[model samples]
Target: MRLATGGIMHETHTFSAEPTAIETFDVARGAELWRYAGTNHSVGGVVDACRARRIGLLPTFFATAVSTAAADRATFEAMAGELVAGIAAALPVDGIVLTLHGAMVAEGFPDAEAEVVRRVREVAGPDLPIAVTLDLHANIGQAMVEASTVVVGYDTYPHLDAAERAREAVDLLVATVEGRIRPTMALVKPPLLPVPQAMFTALPPFKTLFERAHALEAAEEALVITIAGGFPYADVPMAGMSVLAVTDADIQRAERIARELADLAWAHRAEMVIRNVPPGEAVAAAIRHPERPVVLVDVGDNIGGGTPGDGTVLLAELLAQGAQDATIFIADAEAVRAAVAAGVGGTVETAVGGKTDDLHGPPVPVRGRVRLLGDGRFVHEGPENAGVPADMGPTAVVRVEGVNLVLTSRKLMPGDLQQLKTVGIDPLRQQILVVKAAVRWRGGYGPITRHAIDVDTPGLGSVDLNRFRFEQLRRPIYPLDAESTW
Candidate 1:
């Protein structure tokens, strides 16, 4: 059997003042897509699965990037047109597999992933099966469900299960093509918008829901089940938790299981709330902790959640509170250029961070010595996104008053330790570390740090849903509205 695969992925933060331009996306065409092989990413899983299944794989066009604002109208259209055209050119394939982030929002396309799936459906006639893999943060809608034959979402919130989900998607696609199974799906959305911080799958509440999903799948009651925590940052209409079930030609079973799981999640709605510590208190606590390294999470500037990585609130607090042995990463191209001009071991006097917008915090002036410099390229050595190569453009580290400030020319999510270890800063040697991220940061920092605190810093990615003004979100959602009911 032959299968064609490709899709665009992004987690859009509608509150962000910036528009994701075409220049910001990373594109991979035809043979280039195989570079992801051996990595933990979805693309890598697709390549490996097809090889193991002895299926002919046709690689198309794929473009993705770190979470950010809505895609520019022209940029999204151009990419979407290219993606559909690529799949069209590779016609006569038995099936297709698409990897997408369902929370994506572009200008004129509130349900961007659905739109991409729709376009692909138009290219490929109605009979062919299309299998899709999605992140756990997907805000799934009926359009995505009606367009795709089988939809599979990651079960783990830190998203360690994406590779497994990809393998499952490929397996389902092959089975459908062979006439071994007829996949029927059902989707349910709860009135819940739990923040990512409180949705870690290994813990309670969230864990219970997935455990039930697993039980049903293991018993062969459902072919696949998904419990998405949903991306609350995107102010789209479908911005909430979702439950999906796929069964072997059994739509009734799919609908029954989906509704059952959604009800279970809603029953635990109050526990799904995310509470944050103030920046001042969080910094002080990190310093006082008996642990050698404490992770201070800047909830507002979460890079993985599509906020600017240049948040200065925690950096300023670390300095004002007289905390030492702290390392903070800030995305500022101007600051990096100034440090590069001084060269290694030279002094740099300039303000770092908070350059993109006024929401995060103003830039903090500092005079520090350049401790390290590199081209900012490394493969993730951690459990998450392992074997994936990351590029931060130009990068440099400046040390000021016993605190190391990492400045990068572009916004790179701190989802892996190699991002710092490649630059020569030991992760275990620091007393306090400031990570501009939500839960995904735990994939790297969680295992090493004795304490991880989520700080209520100011920016577009605030943990508090009340901080933003949503124009397109569905009303009467849980936590957002106390009286909201299913």
Candidate 2:
């Protein structure tokens, strides 16, 4: 069976001032993006399942354009044009599978995933089966549902199962292509939940919800059951919790199951709340206990969540306290370039971060000795980002007195331990490790961290989505309006 694969994955924060241009994305074309975009572990398990079943795999093309900026209309159209053109060239295909982030918002288009699917369907001529896998934080819209036959979303928030969801999309596509099943999708958008960190499935109420969803999936009529705790930062009309169910030609069963799951999510909407502690307090808490490695999470400035990864709030606090043996990664291309020009062991003075959006904090000036430098490209050794070759440009490990800082030309999500090792900084030996991310860090840094604290550092990817005025979002979402009942 001939098939085409490609997608644009970005959890765009509508309030972020950073505009995602064509160059903003780490674009991997043709075969080069297979490991980074195609075979992620979250969807890897499904691919293995398909391989075990002896399904013919067609290598049409796979591209990943992940950016941490609010994509403009031009950027969205350009990406869509490239993906559509690529897929059209590989036409006469039996099926297509796309991996989407689900919360993307372009300048004029709120439902960017729908636009992509619409364009692909227009190219494929509607007869070909189209399937997609979405992040758990997908803000799925009616248009997206109308454009595709089958859609599957990640069950885990930290997204440990990205490969598994991709596998499921492939599995459903194979089934549909083989005429074994007619998959119909049913989606219900209730109210919005807080950031993913608060509603993690590894713990309590969420665990119960997942368990129940799993049980529902085991029922004879159900094919796929997914609860998308939507990404609140994207101010789209469909920005809310949704329950999607895929059933074998049974629209009634699909609708019933989806409604049941949506009702469950709505019942627990109040439970999804995030609280952040100041950076100074978090550092003090970490310093008090030297027995375990304390992870300081700079959530607001998380690059993975659509904020510039160049916040100096945490770094400034660490410096003020004269913290020793602490490691922090700052994405400042200027600083890295300056350090590389000065060469290793050379003393350099530069300003880092606070340059992207000064509302978060001002740039901190630092005079440090360049300890190590690299080309800023490395394959991730961690499970969360494994097999993905990341580029941080010309990076340098700078030692400002006793504090070791990682300065990079490219932005990183802080999910790889190899990121530190590549620059001669060991995270395991450090007393405190500051990561610019939300919960995804748990998959990589969980083993090394004695304790992980979610700190409130000011930036675009704020946990409190209400902090920013959202003009495009649908009104009466959760936390923003506690009295509203969806």
Q: Please, what are the lDDT tens digits per residue for candidate 1 over residues 250-349?
A: 9999999999999999999988987889999999899999988899999889898888899899888888988888999999999999999999999999
The best candidate by lDDT is 1
Question: Per-residue lDDT for 82-144 in model 2, tens only?
Answer: 888888887878888887788888877888888999999999987789998888888888899
**CA lDDT for candidate 1:** 0.89
Total clashing pairs for each candidate: 0, 10
**C-alpha local distance difference test of each model:** 0.89, 0.79
